[model samples]
Target: MNGTGNIVALKPFPDAARLELDDAQLRTNLRRATHTIRDKRLRVVGEVDDWEQLRLSGAAIKDDVLARLPELLERFEEAATKAGAVVHWARDSAEACEIVTALVKETAAREVVKVKSMATQEIGLNEALEAAGIAATETDLAELIVQLAEDTPSHILVPAIHYNRSQIREIFLSKMPGVTRGLTDEPRALAEAARKHLRAKFLTATVGISGANFAIADTGTLVVVESEGNGRMCLTLPQTLISVVGIEKILPDFSSLDVFLQLLPRSSTGERMNPYTSMWTGVTPGDGPQTTHIVLIDNGRTATLSDEVGRQALRCIRCSACLNVCPVYERVGGHAYGSVYPGPIGAILSPQMTGDGANKTLPYASTLCGACFDACPVRINIPEVLVHLRQKGPKSRAEHAAFASISWIMRDRRRYAAALRAARRGSAPLRGRGPLRRLPWPASAWTVSRDLPLPPKESFREWWAKR
Candidate 1:
């Protein structure tokens, strides 16, 4: 996958948010799902005595990897080539998509079974493959649900978190081929329904596509951490396997992986350890896939790396811990962000990826609440980055006017006092109504979800001068 998918083409965040806010059912689902995960994460994370230290270690390791990415990439290529895997480099999303599509065509296979890969989604790989007349099937349960419904993923870990069991059952019964009648919304029933649908694709697929959780540079072993067994199936069953990974995913060695292995599961799924962890070092001849290919994608990562303050976003493990604890996410949910990556991480990461173009409003989507920073396992200061991006963002005419007005007023004490008296008179109508629920055009946007406080009867300056 590549950078194209991350370049969101939707309404500005506030405009999109207006539609999402009216959906009461989405709010209930988001609140319930986020709270459940947040509770479980607290329980599992508390079990580790040195969780804070582990976070620090994780941050330090990623920092080292980013610092030495070029050298490590060279080292990783050498080891992977020796291990019999072909390595490809792509400077951007278009190049990455071309490389993967050509590789799939080389095998003469029309269908590829895909493990759940955010990297592929970021590049819009499925759409690319479909355009090239190759079918890419999503094998993960939640991902399959999203694909079948033709809907975008709403969460990182659980992509279909927006859908309840009933919604999922409907999607399956309507879209899933060969789905049996009388299918129930029961959890077991849903799993069996999806399993039956994907099983045929798994057996007949000749090519497999995946994204690595971590790539060890010294040994060239690519790691995929997953709860379901589907990732293992996709990694092994196919004759040709291709893994697309971001350049930032590489780590120096196995020792660094030890810290992340512990940090990832507890933060992502609230498990002490993942149910399945698939690691392979290139081609193993008759053991697994005979041919393996690795495409390391730069996309916009180099540009993101250039920003010292924004570079901290690269430390993310895609844990969704920040998403679970975010107040804004809990209220409006992921789709409103209009990026594959939503919530706090998306707020900072998306703008960095595409710059302040279509995604400029993303940085201002937050309330500057520090919850995301606190929930981050790697301790990325997300709020700090958000503020940094906002300062860097282009200012609107209204904002410039407002700031200019305040600046001018503050330059003179008499002007400030006169402004305060005018505000008191203007707010007198609001006193009878307690707080202003709605205001005029420019200020109406702010009052849509909030109310302005009533001004005091007399100015503090007036009372002080009289006293």
Candidate 2:
């Protein structure tokens, strides 16, 4: 990715959201999924005795890493090289893709099995591989479904989250090779279908590609936390293994990882611990992959790290907790964000990563409710970053008009009362319906993406007059 390169074309938030808002099915899927995840996170997070302290510790550690990132990168490179793992530094996405492609070609592998990787998605690696005539198979079930459907991921944790099981059944039956029409949408049946589809690819794949959740600088170890066993297979089964890692993923030591292991699961999948947490240091001669490679990608991270306020986004562990709790995300879904990274985190992170471009509009995608901040295990202060980025971008016409209207309304008691009377009259018809979902013109800027409580049928001033 370049200074202005977007992970995906981010149409202005309001415009994209207008289209997403019209999709009743998408809204329903997002609401149900986010609420379920949010409730689960609250349940598991409540069990932790020192959750706040853990968040503080995690933030402090990441801040430390961000502070000394250049030094840590060198230390990590040296340690990883010493452990007999080849280390490659990529300045941008194109260079990183070229390096990985060259590595795969060296092994003469035409097909590679891939573990779900956000970094790879951000860099458009699968597309790059296809351009090079190398097939990249997504082993993650959601990823596979998206691939089969020829659709982009709409969420972080569950890429196919926008697709209901019935939709998935249709996709599998139509696109999945050898899938029987008898395949039902039952969770087990879907899992079985996907398993059978991917089993051959996993067993026969000569090269495997991945992204690291954490990279230990001192030990040259990489960690991947996953709910499914696919990542484990990708890490161990191939003759050659490659990991594309963001430079910020480097942790100084294993002791630092302890805090994160405790926080990430409860915050991400709402589990006490992951089903499969894979860790490896380079390679052992006859075990795992004899040839292991870790590509440290800078892309736009150096620029992002330079910004004092925005740098906090680097601390994100991709838990998706912020996404689950974000009202804006719950309604419009990740597609509206137009980034591999999405939700409240994406609102702040993508703009910084992509520089001054169409993504500049991303900072305004949030409601700034601070639910994201509360849910964040690492305490990234996402709302703060969103505000910081918004200040850097030019304000939208709707924002200016809304504030100007407020200024006018507050100037006189008569004006204010008239405005309130109008609001009450406008809401009277829909008074018992629900929250105000849409409003006229500039006001739609607020009500389009989020619902507002209906105005009171009678103003407090009217009651005061009666009294």
Task: Indicate which candidate wins on TM-score.
Answer: 1
* Whole-model Cα lDDT of every candidate shown, in order: 0.90, 0.88
- Kindly report which residue stretches of model 1 are placed more than 4 angstroms away from their true locations once superposed: 411-415, 425-432, 458-467
| lDDT at 229, model 1 | 88
Single out the weakest 10-residue window by summed lDDT for candidate 2: 1-10
Show the colliding residue pairs in model 1: 2-123
Taking all chains together, each candidate's TM-score versus the true structure is: 0.95, 0.87
CA displacement after TM-score superposition, residue 127 of candidate 2 (Å):
0.4
- Scored against the true structure, residue 295 in model 2 reaches a CA lDDT of 94
Off by over 4 Å in 2: 1-8, 396-467
Error of 1 at 358 (Å): 3.1
Each candidate structure's count of clashing pairs: 1, 1
Please provide, for model 2 over 204-243, each residue's C-alpha lDDT reduced to its tens digit, 9 standing for 90 to 100: 8989999999999888999999978999999999999999
